[model samples]
Target: MSLTIKNLSFSYPDKAVLKNISLSNLPKGKLTVLLGPNAAGKSTFFRSLAGLVDADYEQILINDESLSELTAAERTQRVCYMPQIFSTQAMLTVFEVVLLAQKQLNSWSVTEEDVQSVDALLKQFEIEHLAQRYISELSGGQQQLVSICQAMARSAELFLLDEPTSALDLRHQLQVMQRLKDETQQRDVITIIALHDLSLAARFADNILLMKDGKLQGHGETEFMFSSPLIEDIYGIEIELFRNSKGSLVVTSELK
Candidate 1:
């Protein structure tokens, strides 16, 4: 099960956002990182994939099935999108929010499996201690964790997360990416995350999708993408890329 996007384009009334972007053979069971500077249309691209925007595309295929053909409910069943900004105003407990996500497309009655799934997600995220607390009461990082739990509670073939680590500390950022990678492989799901951290993207991403000015600057394996001069071109900065003694990719940047 792979994903393919062909000739995708989008625009607002006064401005064009995406311009004939095309990518193919985005393999399943791997983490793909979307890398770009701010206002590079990363969020808009995600919204298009989630069917939240009316983008023009020749085809958006998953497992060779056309995403445009799927009804709203069907698309929801296949795709789980966690946006960059999430509302913490819901009065529900942390567990309840996750449980609701598990049962979002189902009947009102909850199943034992749903309860168990929600419990497992919270524990996996190390947030079982906050299960009873309301989302409105948690800190930003804690709320982000809960939002992740909610997204993971759902059954889906594709996961789209926008800046999921933006609010997290160093430890939690590592934890979240590690767990996401593990889950993506374990479930054979295609997970795409938009991130600003080049080091993190290089560390965990199997493929890197680079965008600039609403255009696809590059798409390839982590090493290939990072080696390209487009990295500096897109961000308008001078960067040094190297592998540390531990053999992990590291990126250091300075203003040009």
Candidate 2:
């Protein structure tokens, strides 16, 4: 199952966000990184694929079917998009919040399997004990994790996550990225994640799509941007790439 996005563009009433953007169907089972700085339309692009943000139907296709063919529920089932903004101030507990997502599995009813999966996800994130804790009571980082787990709990083939590690600490960030990578390989899921950490992106992503100002600046293999020019163009900063004694890629800013 592949996704095709052609000439997809969007704009707020006052500001144009995406220009003439087109990306081909990404292969199944490969991890792709949408790399961009702030306000480069990364989250907007994810929304376009999930059909949450309005777009021209002719431009967005999931599998061979147009995104227009899928109902809101159907789209939610096929694609899991972790939006940039999430807040649960409804006095719902963490477990309760997850249960809410499980409820999305079926419109009118929740199932035993859904509950079981919710339990599994809670445990997977090592937040099983916090299950009973109110979402309003959790720390910002903890809240972020619970929200992410809720998003991941959806049985979706395509996962579009926006800066999932932003709220996580270094260790949890690594854990989450590793888990996503492992799950994608195990299930052959098509995953697209937006990340600012180049090291993490280099370590896991099979393909990297670099964007600047709502335009694609680079799209290729993991090792394609070893040079300084491309990085400078997309990031607008001088950077240096070095190999550690252990031979891992290290990216550092180059001072003028």
**Cα-based TM-score, every candidate:** 0.97, 0.91
lDDT of residue 68 for candidate 2: 73
Error of 1 at 106 (Å): 0.8
Candidate-wise lDDT, in order? 0.92, 0.80
lDDT of 1 by residue, 4-107 (tens): 99999999999999999999989999999999999999999989989899999999998788998999999989989999997878898998889888898589
lDDT of 2 at 75: 80
- What TM-score would candidate 1 get against the native? 0.97
Candidate 2: residue 144 lDDT (0-100):
83
Model 2 stretches with alpha carbons more than 4 Å out: 105-110, 226-228, 245-247
Which residue ranges in model 1 land beyond 4 Å of their true spot?
Answer: none
Residue 76 displacement (Å), model 2: 2.2
